[model samples]
Target chain A: MNPIAQYPFEISVEKVLKSSMVADPLTLLDCSPLTDGAAAIILAREDIAKKYTDTPVYLTGSGQASDTLALHDRSSLTGVLAAKIASEKAYKMAGVTAKDIPVAEVHDCFSIAELMAIEDIGFVSKGEGGKFVQDGQTKIGGKVAVNTSGGLKACGHPVGATGIKQAAEIVIQLRGDAGKRQVDGAEIGLTHNVGGSGATCVVNIFRR
Target chain B: MHKTSVPGVWRRFKNRYQIVGTQCETCKTNFYPPRELCPKCRRGGKISEKKFAGLGKIVTYTRVHAAPAGYEKQVPYAVAIVQLEEGPMLTTQIVDYNTDELKIGQSVRATFRKMYEDGDEGIIHYGTKFTPIRES
Candidate 1:
């Protein structure tokens, strides 16, 4: 079956079929598709960036970390420790905290993954992420706009392209180029990308 | 199909069959899919082989309907993060139960099973999978 045609949010007869194809509690809708795509952005020093674009999005800080290749080797299954470490380093280097960022592009390969990313990156306290999302805190114009690009969940995760895609989304938001989905007055944004289960993670902070 | 050589299979026999892992002497940390060095202690920590009891519980799980390249036959299978009794956690398939029957914190124990056959000419790989521990 062409899974892309069966996105749960879209109205289609295939949606019902796709929903039933997976075991209960998690359907195909919860997972990201293996898509083919690419994304790229030219980054430069502040002086060079200012010369290139009037509204240059500054790459304030970047951090990366790795854990065990296998998911089970990690201490906590609920959150990605690598993500936590990476984001913390990014935040420190950027001289900002999660609350300081009003918008973010998070890795949401699976629905559950988004929840874990929010918590792991310190947007919400551990175990409170589900509630935070449920309360509409992650929606555009909420406490923090997350996945303004529709995320990997709807944006289509092209493995190698995911990190670049995330960065592009954040840069677009910080540059005030995102059309209707743009978060109002978004000055600072963050992008998170994970490889494999949670083995590798990269976090980048961008500011207008 | 994925290919596995005789030596590759032989090297992991102790871990796949007996669940042997490693423990760091300096920090007393344990590892599954055993590592040669302690990430925390690096070169300073001494490592020693340790055998696990093969008993643990599910920390979290997902019913993977989308099978990867060579695992199409195992579609809709339950995979979980199992925390072993000693300390280390490992990702392994949970067998002999339906999705509804599994839950976080449910007790489980390792059982030998066929992971997959590489190909017609390749080795039939074996590994430990977890199953719900039946209450007596």
Candidate 2:
């Protein structure tokens, strides 16, 4: 999508359910669309960052991990092993736990993936993500605001730009520039980016 | 025409004809699609060809209602992850079962069948597929 997108229609659960089925467990609504978009961030050292802006969001921690290429080689289908490993590394570096995060942007390449990623990244105990979402815990005012940008589902996934787009969402949330979608008074935020069905995963934490 | 090299298919005839994989003697590990060396044991383990009897149970499955590219005619086919008796799992299409009837832990056995036709006049590719093992 372009820098500013104007959605012409409304999205609801009923419309999604009525959408065409691409696969038995996954529907056309569940999959992200291939969008034409691009995102860029200017990184600066502390001294240079201070020269540029007074409200520079700090990149506190980052972690990356990989899993077996073959899905059959994986131990479980319900969780992403790489996401857990990567997020743990990031949390350890940031000196914070999942409870400290008030806002997050996770890879929602598919709806089921969002459920699995929240569990893998330790946002909620394993198997609780489904229930957590069902109770409206991921909304803007809910327990921990997730995917405030409507995630990849509605925001559009431009493959390579998806990761940076996620980070940009967190940056906006942490800097209090996200407008109505902002998680109120969010000081720390996190973004999770995945590649090719959990073969690769990356997590980054930001603070302002 | 979706072209698949004859050499590529020819090389994997063993795996396509039957469930032939590799096993490491040191750690008693099995691999499907085979491996050049043991991932865990590496140079320390003895590797050999292992022929499996193809009996297994379904771990998970999906019916693909949307086929990609040249496979548009094969929509709504059943695909599943089957855990073989030898411990390794394989991703294969499930045959001879209703798409809605596929279930987790359902007993299954491998069967050889035509995988795809390259094009209208292209060669027919054959490979192993799993089917539900019906009880008498």
Candidate 3:
């Protein structure tokens, strides 16, 4: 058996399937697909950045935090505290609150992840994430746009490359390069990447 | 082997059949899949082996349609993390239940099973697994 698989931690499924043992009423198929890929982003100062493209965005705030690797020590399994810390730093750097983030590309390795990101990034209150999605607050044109690239659920998780991929996607959206997944007139954005059951998380805020 | 060491050795082997873990005396923290030290407290205090009932809650899992090189044949299998009642979580094959029946927070019990057999007639690897506790 893989040694890491045997690590002490909590596990939960965020998506439902037609077949399963009701083990948390979630299924494996609903989880994000682990993948292998690479992504990159180019950053430049505002004054000299105009040459690269007509619009240049700023990476305002960024933070990364770690939590108990074992899920048993966590106060709540459904959400991650590390993400909240990272988001706070990013939000503050952007000179905005959750309300200013018109669209976001979050880590949705599982369907429930998008919901959790909503709360972790301060977009909504804890436990209210599920409702936010159900209410269409995270849809393309609603209050915010989330995971338009199909997220980890549909896209893929290449581990070391997932974080960079998110940054690339945000840049595309800010530059209106996301083809069909682009958000209309997105001025500010956020990205959240988590590692190993929320033990590690990074939040980055950007402005166009 | 010396008689004085026999009892301790036997006890150690017996722990393999069950999910045995270690707890740091100073930190009061337990480790799953067993470890030598406390990751949280960072203090390498007294460590003691402890047996844990495999009963746990299902956190999240995945049905691997495509596995790594060695596990290619066992496609469409279930892998999940079960949060033990005492503390710590374990990842193991979930079997004897429909894949659709998986749910978050569902209770399960450990069982011994063939993890994978080697070669055509080589050694059969045994490992721990979990299944839904059938409610009467």
Highest-lDDT candidate:
2
Models sorted by DockQ, best on top:
2, 1, 3
Which lDDT tens digits does candidate 2 get at residues B64-133? 9989876678887888899999988999999999644599999999998988888888888778999999
Candidate 2, A1-208: lDDT as tens digits:
2235323245788878888888887889889887898888778998999999999989998999999877888988989999999999999999999999999989999999999999999989999999999999998888888888878877878899989988888888888888767688999999999997999999999999
* Cα TM-score of candidate 3: 0.69
Between candidates 1 and 2, which one is better according to DockQ? 2
TM for every model, in the order presented, reads 0.83, 0.94, 0.69
What C-alpha lDDT, on a 0 to 100 scale, does residue A187 get in candidate 1? 91
**Candidate 3 Cα misplacement greater than 4 A, ranges:** A1-38, A45-54, A68-75, A153-161, A176-182, B1-16, B53-85, B93-110, B130-136
Q: Write the per-residue lDDT of candidate 1 for residues B66-129, one digit (tens) a residue.
A: 6776678888788888899998888899999855559999899999998887877887777799
What's the lDDT for all of these models?
0.85, 0.88, 0.76
Clashing pairs in 2: none
State in Å the error of residue A57, model 2: 1.0
lDDT of 3 by residue, B1-136 (tens): 6456543553455445578888888877777767787776666577888788789988877677646665667766777778898788877778887755677777889998777766777656566889988779
CA deviation > 4 Å runs, candidate 2: A1-9, B1-12, B99-101
Write down the C-alpha DockQ for each prediction. 0.43, 0.82, 0.09
Q: How would you encode candidate 1's per-residue C-alpha lDDT over A88-138 as one tens digit per residue?
A: 999999999999989999999888899999999999999999999989999
**Candidate 1 Cα deviation (angstroms), residue A22:** 5.0
